[model samples]
Target: MNTAGEHMISEIVGYISELVPIHVDKTKTELSSIMTKYHVTKVENEDVHPDLTEKIQLFLSSKRLEGLAERTLDGYAMELRIFADHVKKKADNITSADIRVFLGNFPNLKMSTVGKKLFALKSFFGWLAGEELIKRDPTAKLKPPKTEKRLPKALTIEELELLRESCKTVRERAFIEVFYATGCRLSEIQKLNVSDINFQSMSCKVIGKGNKEREVYLSFKALFHLKKYLQSRNDDCEALFVTQRKPYRRLTGRGIQREVKNISRNCGLEDKVHVHVLRHTFATLTLNQGADIVAIQEILGHSDPSTTQRYARITEERKREQHKKYLVL
Candidate 1:
């Protein structure tokens, strides 16, 4: 083989070794033999331009224009960059087998991580196909890895009371109460403006994922605590939740997580506590009190009923356990 062809074969062997967990020498020898048999001249397609990164940027731009959340756009960019790095080929030149190998290489990744990566790649390739950038979609037949269906962890009423008791400041108390009462996602609560709350109606509008707005009702106790917290704040910032210090800024998701973690530690709860747990507690408690699943779905701003159905699963499991323990049979 010519020097250029030999160089291409070596590069192909190295890439295959990275993807397959095989020894470099063995992969090189095997690939060299296969190349010799097939008269392979090049690894990457000669006609394909090296513009995968540029194409990805364009795709992300389209997503931004479509009003995708910045976080979601960031995820797509990161995942696609990882895929491009692994495959080391032009977007249009990537094959289904190559995509499968790239994903399979990350055997240690969480199922959710794998699923997110697959979704990004599938979307990218589907877009490319739609735009006639590629002859076929590489991810058309690809399936995301199945994630385990673990039930949402929710704090019991007694544990919640303990958490409330652990809070020495109004801010912490009000934050926990709002989480339990509204069942809002951490991002939703953090993005809340002070003007969003309607004290008379005891409800607040939360901007949820995809910038969808929904009303989350506040309990009487929650309303009282929120009023107290707001009264204590001296900042002119419009954010409902803000840092306690001077020059107060809106609380971030991480800030709320830290607050919840500290409160859980102070309360001495055994299980790990976080904002989502409080949201789960709200849903489970509401369902146990006979709230309709459809109503819960709407309040939670769930675009799909199946996502809301998980709370119903938790309620059903509790009923089964109670039956087993209390029945005289």
Candidate 2:
């Protein structure tokens, strides 16, 4: 059965189930009978149009040349594969209406998830049109759904202190301090090498999205703990952070994340804390201390100024709250 037909059947079944409380097993049996009588067979093996696959390959190759990250390329490939499997149409024959219908099928997904899908499609179709692979862009008129601009959540000074006190190991203490000081993303920190640190300059080089390298500063406190952790290590691993056991290896991103969750749990914090929360705390605290937005952007390795501006907004709200609490008038 085609997607549309399957969707229609699902809707009818849902309506019947809601209007009359039938036994769930009986409902499934009856639905199966209906499907069998109608000779409705799922068309899962239809060959995707060669033009579509060819254009997707060309688009991904161009994006690779343009310095897109491998993870980003994989996401594009996954989204495009789903679209191609659904439409099974040539790149040139795909219409905006078809795109709309495709998007409509994902009614239960979050706006952010749907928006990501739309972005991938738009990028693929836009690339095809730009390269003259397709005469017209099917997604030219499509717009992403607006996502809410929530302030980045930062840890309070008290919460930071609590987390610090919760650390049971030198490595854990060092991990928290470095993440809080540098504001590097999880991947950046995971990929960090001991050689990347320049103790003389109190800074380290980190490769951010799109493999762009930038320098992030370490605080005196972070340097103290990091040095202590390194001194405590007996392994020969070059990774800045490594597993505690013998035969130690570079800590994976998930390993770092698991450590963060453990610290959060140990701290008895009400909110779920992650690596990005440490990043937000760094940005919020630094900006509150009068760091320049542009400078913070460079330190955080943000390609877009607007992405760093969210931290500015957070400081503004904090300032207003401080004023309210302190005003004597």
Candidate topping lDDT: 2
Per-residue lDDT tens digits for candidate 2, residues 19-39, read: 988776666556766765564
Cα misplacement distance, residue 273 of candidate 2 (Å)? 0.6
Please name the candidate that would achieve the greatest TM-score relative to the true structure: 2
Model 2 residue 221 lDDT?
98
Model 2: worst 10 consecutive residues (lDDT sum): 36-45
| Superposition TM-score, candidate 2 onto the true structure | 0.81
Report clashes for each candidate as comma-separated counts: 0, 2
What TM-score, over all chains together, does every model reach? 0.80, 0.81
lDDT of 1 by residue, 2-56 (tens): 6665787787877877787878877767667766755444446433344787788
Superposed model 1: Cα runs more than 4 Å off: 1-50, 314-329
Q: Record all residue pairs in model 2 with backbone atoms less than 3 Å apart, i.e. clashing.
A: 1-41, 1-42
lDDT of every predicted structure (CA atoms): 0.85, 0.88
